[model samples]
Target: MNKRKIIDRTLLTDLAKDVGLNASHLEALGESCQWEIGVDGDMLERLVEIQHQFERLAVMGDDEYRGFYIEVPRPAPEEWGDAEELIASGEYDSREAFLADWLAFNPMETRWFHVASNRYGDSRSIRVTDRKHTHFIITNHSKCTDAEPDDTWCRENLTRLFDYLQRMIDVIVANPDGFNDYVAHNLPYQQRTGRIAQKEFNRIVPNCKIEVEDKETAIKALEDSVHGRSVPPLETMTIRQYCSYYRIANEAYEAYYRKRGASGRFYEDPQDVPEELRDVAYYKRIKFVDEEILYDIDSPEDFIRFATDHYGELGLSRLNIFASNKRQKGWMIIVSNSYSANVGLAIEVATALYKARAPLLIYDAEKLLRILLEEDYVRLVPDSYHNYMGYQEEGSVYELPWEYECSEDTDSVLNKEQYQAIISNAEWQPEEQAKPIA
Candidate 1:
């Protein structure tokens, strides 16, 4: 039997990291893309209506088109029990009679109707349903043109729709923990394993409506096994506790591996590995496990040699360079991502601002851009304070891009006078402006 390897969640996270995109954002993008390709269940119905309208216009004002005319019909509201009784009692034998009675007391616009045709020398008809009740222009039409709708227009509309959906998905993914808590108990029996934990189980199944009143009893029955007080000496506790213990054991194993220093790189033979850390295909399975990165490189002597050869002095220099250019000066503060020194590029760029004498005010660039600017030796301050604590009051301190979070901090700074000057002196040059994407 061929055993399929499961990639753990860590590996997936690592893959996301490697691609420089968040999983939530990726999911949003994927959904949006799928929607663009017409994964919607109702899309075919919509397309059918559109095509039917074209068919209805083919042959008009002919005797054969008598029953093909559009008819507006309405059904009684569900709240009308009396109407339901009459409808069941056959008080109104035909649809028209029922509709006439329906319209007498409660009048409403009919949004859907059918346009059919029998002039094709055979019976041909179409039923059109309006998805949106937009105002329709009734007019005479020539033959149905075979030309398709504009591709660019369709693409633009689809793109806009997808983008809106993606934004909503991003917001949802960012707060997974909160959403999970809301669905914990009411989930169905079949979907119990769908969630990461009980809290998450409750969240996604919020409307499942299953009662879970005696949760404590189940927990107590499994408690003896969880705390290792069960009767079976060899059997151990319940599955949930077993999972908890497995998590703890993995943590301990990782801690142990990390404590062994660079020498520990040689501990795991390339051919042999702990079961938990064996898989490399999964991000969770291989991340920080050390064995994957340093596996098979031979003894400590060989491992040390490899490290020195590949990442020793140059790596140290890179680390030093990263550390030195990391911190960015906010108007009244300094900030840096302590774990990763990705701001080195920004420091270099910020240095240019300093050289240009673009004011000591913070340039609201991204961390990297700020670091690049700082390489130019620009002095920026946090808006909250004056002077780097020297207590000098500056008039109307502007927030720089460094302080503001943006995927790319490229927004240029302009004083009130400068902005006014541009507005006053600017000329209309439509030709020079780039046309927006449709």
Candidate 2:
């Protein structure tokens, strides 16, 4: 698969880069994004919604209309037939009819005969120019007519066109991370990150995994195995011969090694046995069971999707979700095949399942984002002054280990002016003047 490329852009930054147009036009031009999606398609889709605005500037309801610059080439003097003869001959009609005939009767001269529309005279043609200046208006109807250099053209018509362009730029650019974020929202409860150390076995499985976090646990586990701390050797085990040697009941065997087999869930209650002794065996293993593990997961998002899709029905219904950055590659390991029902799913998996059944309520998006992204500013005072020294002032300082332990209320972090500024900005966000995007 090809690596995903993330393209991030803001339209205002982009509008500045469109160097072809002058400041007059580009100054008011809004921004847009079209992340691999065609810009033309996006623009056209939005323009259809605001066609009603075009009528606001019309002199009369435009029927036969035009709105683009065209070369007004003078017809050759030779082709300019006698106006008197053409008029009296009953060939010429009104001013509009005469204008149409003038263009048709004239032969090609290759002057600045600009024609933006291929189907000009009688048909409808709409266009939106980029980086090039092309603005014209001609119409037989009164409602759609827009005469240049007039208030109607300035206020009603031009504003509407710029307004339409702004809407197209507001769409955010799509990226690969967006897909990951999307998957996170839709992820099923069963596919979150999990740990393998949380299982329980009810039977005597020959060999299984033992959980170890750091060097301390590993070292202790190692010491237990070498010193035979888990179980007494058969020779040292007095249970078998206890009936002969001690005159005690034969139940001595079961009593001495009570729950030693652990019914196989050794991790749950080793029954005072060392953790390294996950099973009756002396070997330290990292697996929960002896069977072959088959669930293969790649990315965190893929893990969620696959696990949720095949939860419980697969041989192994649980998965271990390891956190890794990009460059990792997908499989869902189910837990059913773990050979025992006592093996448990990781806490994250359980949390995910719980969330699936009862999702969290998001009352405020801004507050949630702030909480997620905010960093704590810890005030570590020097050891010399101690707790009570700096807190002489009313609300300037927060003493540690006492006020913190007591759960005392904190004073406002912002000063009066700072608070006022922040409050004003918050209140003004929606009221700020923005070029209309409709």
Indicate which candidate wins on lDDT: 1
Q: Model 2 compared with the native: what TM-score?
A: 0.14
Off by over 4 Å in 1: 1-35, 38-341, 344-438
Q: How many steric clashes between backbone atoms does each model show?
A: 43, 28
How well does candidate 1 score on lDDT at residue 279? 32
lDDT of each: 0.28, 0.25
Lowest lDDT 10-residue stretch of candidate 1 = 428-437
Q: Which is the leading candidate under TM-score?
A: 1
Q: Give one digit per residue, the lDDT tens place, for model 2 in 78-109.
A: 23456556767878755456656765644332
User: Candidate 2: deviation at residue 405, Å?
Assistant: 32
Backbone clashes, candidate 2: 28
lDDT of 1 by residue, 27-64 (tens): 23223322223312243344333334333222334633
